[model samples]
Target: MSFPQLLTPEEKLAQGKTALGIRDVVVLCGSMRFAADMAEVAIQESVAGALVLKPDCNMKIAHPLWADPVEAEALKVRLDDQHKQKIRLADRVIVVGDYIGDSTRGEIAYARELGKPIRFTDPEVDPGEPGGDPAAEETAR
Candidate 1:
């Protein structure tokens, strides 16, 4: 008697999504300054029949909850971790802005490590592509 082969993490995620009747899982990554751009991309992804995941909060927004420097820093760390989880779960990543900040760059790297396909709203800013500048920030805008 032989045991079945164990599934890879990507395979496991695909199986789970299939069990849930999800066709495609797309995660959006970008600077919080382009939250509006991300929102637009989310809508487009949804309309295209993808299950979209994105940052749910814009910490840059003036909020009493995160007004304290220490508290805001802690929240930022937690949020970044959560976004990485989203990238792990997603089958693909869509970067939703012309700008790629440090946080977004990290997310893109994580997604690449997971072998997830990545697309950019502004293709010129895609670090994985030819002539794409990883250090570029807000230059395309």
Candidate 2:
């Protein structure tokens, strides 16, 4: 009978490195308030050979001038759900912002629950970092 050979730790590490070289399907998550920033990050990731997915935060559709407050709130909920679905499909989530709002915070929590890797555009702005809250800094100004 032939035996199947198991891979050594070094062999497994090599395989992981090989896989890392392949393009990753990354989902960009952030508030619509920072849509432009999110788009910039998406473009940068795409240029780096990653398959990037971002929410369609086009101002034409989501602008408050067009929708009443009630309607706008409903739309925001729907859009947030869609973004969560995208995060479920992604290999990793990149949060693009200096200060994360409630929606982005929820997305980060969801991504953590799913055990996906999470990255931020500004490491200094992370909640755990010292002087991370821009609002505090602004108040001090």
Candidate 3:
């Protein structure tokens, strides 16, 4: 008379295992050139782009540089510790490119060393253009 017997075999199996919940992703951007003043917009675009293609994903972001660094050691400590923590916690990372060199390179390398899924996506773009406008882009997140 209980619900357990009423449930199909598949439902019973599913009930025994933990639900595979929605995944969380964090993006590591290559360019901080525009991120300084427009951090919110820039980050939003990056995160949205990733989630747009991959719905049901949670997104976080990381800065390539530590702004509040008090000294050289402080800078390394903040960057190495905080940045790595976020990346390690992320389920996946999307590396954006205006034209990649160091920023993309470093982010990709770090994510790779951690054995996370890594992919590259286009920077936001205007309606018809190939890529996004450099000046007006906003960090929406």
Best by TM-score: 1
Query: After best superposition, candidate 1 residue 112: deviation in angstroms?
Result: 0.5
* Global Cα RMSD, each model: 5.0, 8.8, 12.6
Across 5-115, the per-residue lDDT of candidate 3 in tens digits comes to 488653554455335543344545445453442345345746665321211111223444433435544755555456666665565665554556553466556766665
Model 2: which residue pairs collide? none
lDDT of 1 by residue, 82-110 (tens): 99999988878888888888888888888
Error of 1 at 110 (Å): 0.7
| Window of ten residues with lowest summed lDDT in model 2 | 132-141
Please provide TM-scores, in order, for all candidate models, with all chains considered together: 0.86, 0.66, 0.43
Candidates sorted on lDDT, descending = 1, 2, 3
Candidate 3, superposed: residue stretches over 4 Å from native: 1-22, 36-73, 123-141
Better of 1 and 3 by TM-score: 1
Cα-based RMSD of candidate 1:
5.0
Order candidates by TM-score, high to low.
1, 2, 3
